[model samples]
Target: MRASKNRSQKSEVRSQNPKTYEIHISGAEGVYEDAEILKIVKEYTNRALNHPKGKPDNIVITLEQIKQIPQKVPMLPVITLKCNSPDKAKEMIFQILSDIGVPARTIKNSFKILTSPRTMRGAAIILKESGVRVEPDRERGVRVSRLGIEKNTEKILVRKLSKMKVSITTVKEALILASKVAAYTDVIAEICISDDPDYTTGYIASKRLGYIRIPNIKSHGQNYGGRVFIVRENTNINRLIKYLEKTPIIISGDIN
Candidate 1:
């Protein structure tokens, strides 16, 4: 009877371990530096150590930055510290782990942050909480989708751009514009431009499609990204016109 019970326990353990998941981590826009990211990771690790639940076994850390390369590295659950700069932090942590005889590796230019090791209570707790289900599509994918910008239009446009075979230059410009527009409105707007000698014609085409090109607005600043101008909810055109005429117009989308 004792032998049978031990076998059952081993089976349960095998069933609970999931092979992989899509994980990401990022700091508040403009607030994320290597040091800040390290701090967050350290805090998470410490909390896991003291957690009443089990501790995580193997951890993977991925660092992400804009216009910069990303880095991925393995981490030790016990001795690793949190990082501020994702790159430097992960490198330092990896070095420490290596000194202590932990196996680890580092990868560069990763598009996403790391979220792994189940964080405290070990694999058993993670298996319980995550309900350990295996999907064939979960492995070895790009890390670009981890950044959660709330606008739906931006998401759609980004997806659309990813499918096309456009030149990198055009794609870059489109991504910049799409990101700026997505900041203000929930509607996903899309743009497709053909090679045209006359820039005015292209501008006219964009305007005809209800996309008003923002002029003199910095890409990252307020007041000049893609903004939606609408009057109000349940308001008639005449009332909207009157309001626009009388008030300093601040046009957001259909405000509830």
Candidate 2:
């Protein structure tokens, strides 16, 4: 079997802020034993930590094991959440964030990004968990992936997923990743809407609220959904990225 592993790191910006890093694992199309996967993760993570940049403040790991199924599963109906007015929907969303300790200014900006027409595909918004930018400008929120989950705090996630009945190994793996991100030093909360055309639900996860599902966060046939992560200022962007790409975290706790 021909399998290839890749590792690389880049700065999120040239400024003095702590740089963000990414370590990606791909090009493997065959199944391997669990011990083998763990070995790969440890070996790479050690290399990253030993680099000249020094040890990262946090670490997270993701393993996307690809598999093919012969048949397609049917899509479920969109979970519709009714509201009395247009603002009501926004209010409810804002309330969830507020209840979970997201700053007032951050909440407003996150909502703008979520509803904005310019929100791009294949990307999520990253904002300071404690800032007060008057508008939802790009500087206020960066369009990036793998940052919110450190692409969303990993700790806030485990509590949410731990309560669910996740049978699929992939789903459980994802939940563990989110949990790890939420637990980082600077991370605080995360909200996500699936970009899948067939899926219409979204979720808000934090250390306080656990995982609360929003039944109808998006519309069927619409593919504009995304994720938002709120984190503390001056967080090391490079260190966070390294964790997301390099760490190999196991699916802990009882996943029934």
Candidate 3:
């Protein structure tokens, strides 16, 4: 019996393939000092592999020593908007930092504290137009279809926050951070003013830039500062250099 069990175990080891996960790690903004972070990640990865109380069965992990990564191809310049928010400018700072495009895993649990309702009123309106009946369930506080009921509970409403405008002072700080993010990522993102004229000095440097803050319209805010634009006034080499240098930041976290 013992010999038979040993043979079976050996066969299983030979037949099963090792599951390897590839992870890329990068950080900026003065958070970690290399060795400390690498060690922490190494330990964390081990914990992930052996999650749920103890070491997992039939698993092997191999880690590579720290090595230099290759040069990065420059991404397009991101158009950055001056930040303004109602709540002590924290929102402005968050929007600016979001442009850095940190990997999603890092931010996944960050918003868990929020438990707000998600509304589908806009979708309900569209469905109503399409001849589909959308009924509101006051008990559940959500919209539902005539045939199949849809409900929302314990959800966060992100749209409502857009109403709060950031202060002008925060906008300047966010602008600096946005510039850094754009230069680092090499992707030019859109910059939308807060519908406040005070931001003109920050974004109205060129006529190619325009204002349209409608959230319902598909192309409303898309036409703002972005990758492709003609610089009409400056033809000199110095002007071109200056323009190239001031790449705006688009948050890597979102497609927009």
lDDT of 3 by residue, 102-220 (tens): 22322222221111122111111101012222223211212111110011100111222233343332332233333332342222232322211122322311211222121211122
Worst 10 residues of 1 by lDDT: 119-128
Worst 10 residues of 2 by lDDT: 70-79
- For candidate 3, the per-residue lDDT at 30 reads 13
Ranking 2 against 3 by lDDT, winner = 2
Task: Provide backbone clash counts, one per model.
Answer: 17, 21, 18
Q: Which stretches of candidate 2 lie over 4 Å from their true place?
A: 1-89, 116-125, 129-174
Tell me the deviation in Å of residue 243 in model 3: 5.6
Across residues 113-212, which tens digit of lDDT does each residue of candidate 2 receive?
Answer: 6666433322243556655332244422332222112212335344544555432322333344345556555666766765444555566665455545
lDDT of 2: 0.46
lDDT of 1 at 2: 5
Q: Give the residue spans of candidate 3 off by over 4 A.
A: 1-163, 166-229, 243-256
For residues 57-140, what per-residue lDDT tens digits would candidate 1 score against the true structure?
434344545453322111101111233343443355335334433333211111011222211110010011122212112332
Per-residue lDDT for 254 in model 2? 28
lDDT on C-alpha atoms for all candidate structures? 0.26, 0.46, 0.25
List the candidate 1 regions with Cα displacement exceeding 4 Å.
1-9, 12-31, 68-256
Q: What is the C-alpha local distance difference test score of candidate 1?
A: 0.26
